[model samples]
Target: MVSRVELFALIRRDARVEGLSVRALADRHGVHRRTVRQALGSAVPPPRKTPARSSPVTGPLREAMDEILRADLDAPRKQRHTAHRIWERLVDEHDAEIAYRTVSKYVARRRPEILLEARNRAGVMDGFVPQTHLPGQDAEVDFAEVWVNVGGVDTKCFLFTLRMSFSGKAIHRVYSSQGQEAFFAGHVAAFTELGGVPAGEIRYDNLSSAVRRVCFGRSRVETEKWVLFKSAYGVTSFYCMPGKEGAHEKGGVEGEGGRFRRRWFVPVPKIADISGLAGINDRLAAADHAEDARHIDQRTATIGQDFALEAPLLAALPVDEFDIALTTTPRVDRYARITVRQALYSVPARLIGQTVRAKLDAEELVVLHGSAEVARHPRLTTKGGQHLVLDHYLEVLAGKPGALRGATALVHARQKGWFTATHDAFWAAARAKHGDQAGTRLLIEVLLLHRRMAHAHVIAGIRVTLEAGSVSPDVVAIEARKHAAAAGSTAGDVEVEPPGPQRSRSKVVSLPERRRDSDLPPDSRPAPSVAAYDQLLSNTPKKGNAS
Candidate 1:
């Protein structure tokens, strides 16, 4: 069957080529004279248009639907009304007889018009402009929440990403917290890893780690620590406009985090502890290097190739490193612990009731008495968490031996693998041999060995003492020192003598045997002769009489 286009072509051809009249052409083509006239005017058929159809059922509820959609302009984006929701509202509130499809069709056509009207009234324009970035001049930094299975426990962590605008080269780091220290640390790590800092500016949202308060427009009151860090590194921070308006400003890093997470963190990387972040970051560094070979968007050069061109333009790292640790003076409690960031860390018992300085970074807390570091512990994530080192309370436990059985510090020590089965075995044996009170005191003395000796050496000492059927602390101390000395000895310290009746005695001569022969200079000196000395001796003998 001929379609309208084919029919039109036949009519037009008959009229033009054969010189048929419009009426005759229409009749021959079995069509109206108007159709022949239309074909004569244009070969192409006009597009069919849909006429406006009146909806009797939905027409009465138009005002209510418009009201709902109009209100949606001020509503939160996620909370705004949908077409189905509008239909539901109409049915429930006004008992209007309206099908969902009718309401959906109406909304699909009207919503954009309404939004455009609103935009015009508010005098706002919406459009995206193409961006061009200069090499080594601009970067974007942001922190994104990531889930990691660290130490067999699912933990929420923060991932810091700094992406260069021109090259698309990005540096990523995973941190336990998004604290100020972590913020500062992230920049330092990125600068060091990238071999230099962005020369122009690093863009950021109003993160609390950096910004204390958001002023009008792009102005921000930054935190003191952030200001100091930026100044020290000679960095210029570009704070984006507050809230959702600013999100697009750092879109490079914002999307980079998600892209990186999907590519690398798909399995929610398993790690041993917070300290294991180092390994994950090392993997990310390698991934960054691997990404250098790939091109971004329509760029001709690979990311790595672009970075190579940009690297030399970047600013050099600062000679003086900025301190990212938060320092505080907290008085040691009765438990011989200091409270930092609402977490407890045990210090020496002697420092109880005294204020000691504490320095906290992203991963660890260091407690100090004057210049001497008294204790160190991994930083805790949860509030009110206690990290007690059993060694810290040993001095107190020595006075009250019974408390050692039920001390919280002891429980934590066992959990941390600091108090092992060897220590427990030695404790039980000492109790069996010396009785409870005396045995406990002896165990404290043995525990004291850990303060001065390597932990493995102490454990070895305890094992040896138990195998020897002895519970004496002195015996364990002697065994521990012996293990320490044995571990400290090198193969070079052992005497290796050449095959001879008499051993070479000179330390200088021993060097040849100890060192590789190939490494030493050749023995090129001539053998000493006594012929000149013999004449001098004979002349001196004769001069003894003459003089």
Candidate 2:
């Protein structure tokens, strides 16, 4: 770790005074000859020529091993991990220099430790114990998997789970990753559902989120953050020992996750979107609590009934709910929504594309511009999902003369007899012609037409082609067009152009604004062009055909 500059100063002193050889200098310095030579080089060495430290996995073979691991980590195998097998694989597939014996040593050193594997627990007395607990005293937390639909796409999900030992009351939330923020948010949400933070020890299955160092036995050194959280709520957290053959120690909630999955997640919850998953899970956990369990140690009450009594021990909600999830500042997009977990969340149009802190939790995502709440939605569960709503960008749509989209609220703004029969076919055609983004935006603009017309007129015009009970954005636009012609305000409300002859493929030219260096202040970079455009439009007038 010694700096080369300091080493060079010593080398120069030795070279000037003692005239020591490079090897001698290296010996005196207790370093490599090459290092000593570099320090005392008469000619400067090119930075590119410097050699990095040596490791067992080096050069092409190391890269090959990395690629091999990445490519086949999930390959079907009983145990694809023995040193001989890995060595054979390398020789067969990648032409590696790796010896089978050396591979064994390497794998022994690098293989991640697995502590919890399923096995018989009948004879074991060291696993999770004291399952039947006094009401309001103990809770266990873990993670489980389920399937969910995001933006109409089905994907596997990771859910954090919490359960009360006495009442069998449980709660869980889904997240995209098992990172610190999600773990913290899970704790927050679980505690909230428990009605208060439990007063007794909080138990954990040796997850890295709560423990930093696993000791030799069933003990662990908690992380600074974990310690702080426990102290904040004054609950003792215990981590199960790593690699211990004890099942009973963490058996209660340890098996609960699998039980829940088998009972509930066999077929992933089929839903339209992630926004609906939170409510679904909330209801799902409630149903899970209705199960009946009768044990001698457990009181006469069922798990659900016992949990009801334990619920009272939880602390009351603080004046301000503690944001357990980590927060990073985010900016709104041209659509006036902040993207989190790949989903776009609608914030106020006034704050579109502006820098704001995003507090992410398992249950909900909150975007804030200073003290103002920009947007809130069920927290997303994927890295690349976009949560979009037209209303978040309404002001911006109203400002730009031809901004294609209107607010999401436009979906509801049909007037009576304003747009007439057979608009559905045209609307569907328009949407099909435009991309979803452009189509949704265009629909929002149609809804804005209701500003001048009565709601009944908007409905009437839209219903011309569809049933009276049915509503469509295209119908609203048709009604608005009729009223615009009669009022003479349509010409002024929007540009006189007639929507460019309704091209099948609506050409969207998104003008991205450049953020100069000046716009990037300390601790904050200039907002991206797309996000900025979203904000700019969100602040514009939304009542007219301006978008």
Name the top TM-score candidate. 1
For candidate 2, what is the lDDT? 0.61
Local distance difference test scores for all models: 0.86, 0.61
Summarize candidate 2's per-residue lDDT along 206-291 as a digit string, tens digits.
88777787787766777777776776766767665544344455567777878777776666666655557667767665655445
lDDT of 1 by residue, 53-150 (tens): 98788788888888888999889999999898898888899988778999999899889988999999989787867899999999999998899998
TM-score of 1: 0.78
Compared with the true structure, model 2 gives a TM-score of 0.49
True lDDT of residue 115, candidate 2: 11
